[model samples]
Target: MAANKILIVAEHAGGALNPSTAKCVTCARAIEDGEITVAVFATDGSSVAAQAAALQGVTQVLQIDNAANGHPLAAVLAPQIAALADGFTHVFGPSTTFGKDLMPRVAALIDTPQLSDIMAVESAHCFRRPIYAGNAIITVKVPADLKIVATVRTASFEAVADGGAASVEKRDVQVDLPTHTRFVEISAASSDRPDLQTARTVVSGGRALGSADGFRILYSLAEKLGAAVGASRAAVDAGYVPNDMQVGQTGKIISPELYIAVGISGAIQHLTGIKDARTIVAINKDAEAPIFEVADIGLVGDLFALVPELEKQLA
Candidate 1:
């Protein structure tokens, strides 16, 4: 097989490179004789480009600085990426909101089919992904003749360590960006907690948390451990927390070193989100909860009492 030329779209914010970009580079490295290139699109991507160049497997970095790219609207960036995909064998992005919204547009613009949520690389053209809320794994093969466009499941791959010194090239790509989609103000919940997707440790709550104020217990514990706070879909549905805090098959997928599920009954949809977590600790009164089936440590007790005690002990 010929050397694979892989292009990775870097996801960044506030002039910092998102960790998901490194995971995408790791996925590219799995291909045989692959040459990885990361593209950074921003108003000024020099700093982010430098970070992308430091990824272990990246061969080069392309910095596309344009005022239109100041904000990451898929409509504006997809045309630029498609214009740059002329010779690349594969284009990869993280299966994050940024990538999920952008990669499909890139695939459509380039006239290629996209493979989503790649969990494992079987071969250069064959990959494995989850189905039915991670209850099943399915293998998907792209035609060798077609250019592969995919979204890497960041939770399934470790971020590539930074050790390389790849060169950065500034390119002025010419493409007619769509005017239909304009950048509106982005409203996000502000918190000092670590990001749920990339946090090392996470404390999650379920419908058992009962009310929005009930999440404070997890927040206090999360603060002590420097962990992010998350919630099951049921909790989100019940207005206990915002939708962004949801962690499940329909929500954010996470792979943390330590995952503490409090008051959660461990619905399969919820379990699918944390299946990749290294260590799972379930705190629930019911010993029959399904979360215990996969938990590394199970504490069968009232989370209201156990959680406060655990937080006190961490002090």
Candidate 2:
């Protein structure tokens, strides 16, 4: 089986680089074991393009800068990315809401097969991914001649070290407009700190916190650890925190290096999102909490008392 070049479809926001994109590049580097070309499609692509160039594995960066492609629709960028994949062995994206929605459409548009959320890439043809809420893992293979699209699980791979310059190439691609779905106002979060799903370290609170204020100590802990604040689905459902902070099967799945679950009982749904953590520490009043099963460290005590003590010690 002859190998081919790897093409990474980078995801990003307006100006900030989605850490997941860098991780996907890392996955692409490890899997393809070939040269890499990163493609960024945005209303303006300079920022993401520059970030891509700084990553070590990237041989070249393509900025698919079409001022009309602001929304996350595949039609806007599929033709461009699929066309870009012409010379590459595989095209990859981060397994994010944006990527999950885009990869399939891009595959269909190009008359190819798409694999969503891979745990590992065995080769260009074979990849492993979790199913049944990560209760089972499945390995799949696609023929090499056919184009393959994959969504890389951000938590499963590390971003390659940043150094060396990348060739920033401008691509002249124009696809038909949607004729609908015009850009509108986007109401974003107001917090100054990094978002939970994208943060490298996350401090999550669960039901044991009792109330919103009961979990304030997590902020202190997060500040000390330079981590983002997260909440379990239970807490978010109860309005103890915003929905954006929820971490669970139905919420955002995060793969941070250090994940601190304070007062969370470790429900299977919640665990699904965080089990990928490199290190898990659970603090729950229940000594029998299910979370302890996967936690590297477990504290059977009230988070109210435990968290403040942790904050003091770490500070």
Candidate 3:
């Protein structure tokens, strides 16, 4: 493999590059003396390719435009990515839902081990990742003789700024795609608040929110602070919100600048998602709630009273 040559698979939709793509580049830069290139697969990826080219530390962007890549089916995309894996020492993608679904298939097709949720790059072949719900950290070293495929945990690294002038190139690769799968219509939740994973401030509620209407108070407070709204799995299981709003070990992991948990008991599973947050503020009437163990600031009070007062003060 060429010294320090990395190929990053871009995550995008509707011709716009996802922010996680830039974070993947950040992880790539951590590699000793690595030159980074981004790959975009879509029906018309010109717009996404152009955006990727502007990411700092990127050497180039590879654009593969085809109707077969319209929806990013793992079965269809893995083969295409594997065909382009030659000549690159490392292949990376953001540790997002998209990456989690795509990178393992690419690794299997290329006959290499796939590293998931990589938090740090120790060297070209050595990396660090979390295990056991983030209770422990483990270092892993892959075979130096084989190609490396990795998914970077976007929350662990800051995204690189977009100011570079990396050139975009077209790549034509041929692969056999499965006929058993097809793209279907997507149903996405609409929200005016910031995206939970990328938000600077997040305010989350738990089962104590009681009902869907109770969650509206959290939303109101979130709007006042210009924050994203999240929910614990307990809240979601109770049908207070859609599953997409869940934040926990089995849900979307977030590392915001500020995380405020209201009416939450702070289970270990929920704590794993926000462990990387710069500041954690917990408000629970139960002084014995486990969330206080990790919170930088703990307020032992009723969320119903505390939230309204906090919102008024901000206003």
Candidate 4:
């Protein structure tokens, strides 16, 4: 019955706060009588910490700036996060690539059980999450005596709007960072399109796209719609697109307002990622494709032909 002292690790890049951090704050707010603190780890975290401090219901922000934190490597961050978890009852991070890589390490360091993909909070120790590629939802509970470390499913929660002016405090965490894992140069595909996770609209292709070149029309259509581009796992496995663009149970979970899936046959794995999308549009030749069962609009036709016509309509 005591107040929950929750510490949320803020995820950021390019000195800007990722929207996922605000979503995590929203998740933390659901806990009864919770006092939330956001911890920002960066080379110079003032900007990101400031953003975290402005989210509604945030009580405090801890800004930890160190030259060693120039890149967000899990090996370097987990120790520092564990060192800061002394008095906190719960530790939370967004279930993002950043958090997915870091939270488990922190859990290992702190020797606490970590729950993943928390979609709903029933109490301080109880939560709801999806299982079996999201075909089923299950409730999980952690012991009240144990410190909780978990990842928030960002797609299920709305980001808290900026209204509060919580105070930010600089904290110097003294912990030995690992030297075994070094930051090598990152090789990421650069695109001008909106971020796949946060974009309001997304257009995805599947194995039926056939080849990388076959994806050009999807990109063209995405450009016309001013939406982000995504791909099914089958498309990524077939090398028609990069794995970074893959949208499925094994890839990114997105909640775009409008999702247009072209040539995707609606495998359950792929469907799990877009279940939260507000409107789904499917275009395929097969009338029996499972995607139509969930799609708001269905077009039974050849994508190569239907897509061009759809693009022309958008034009």
Residue 88, candidate 1: C-alpha displacement in angstroms: 0.3
TM-score pick, better of 1 and 2: 1
Alpha-carbon TM-score of each model against the true structure: 0.97, 0.92, 0.98, 0.97
- Model 3 agreement with the true structure over 136-217: per-residue lDDT tens digits: 9999999889899999998899999989999999988887778789887988899889999899999999999899999988
Model 2, CA-based lDDT: 0.82
The segments of candidate 1 whose C-alpha lies over 4 angstroms from its true place after superposition are none
Q: Candidate 2 on 160-210: residue-level lDDT in tens?
A: 778949999888875566655555676765776667876878999987677
True lDDT of residue 240, candidate 2: 83
TM-score result, candidate 4: 0.97
Considering TM-score, which of the candidate structures 2 and 4 is the better prediction for this target?
4
**In candidate 2, which residue pairs clash?**
none
Clashing pairs in 1: none
User: Which 10 consecutive residues of model 4 have the lowest summed lDDT?
Assistant: 1-10
For each of the candidates, the C-alpha root-mean-square deviation to the true structure, in angstroms, is 1.2, 2.1, 1.0, 1.3
* Of candidates 4 and 3, the better by lDDT: 4
2 or 4, which is superior by lDDT? 4
Off by over 4 Å in 3: none
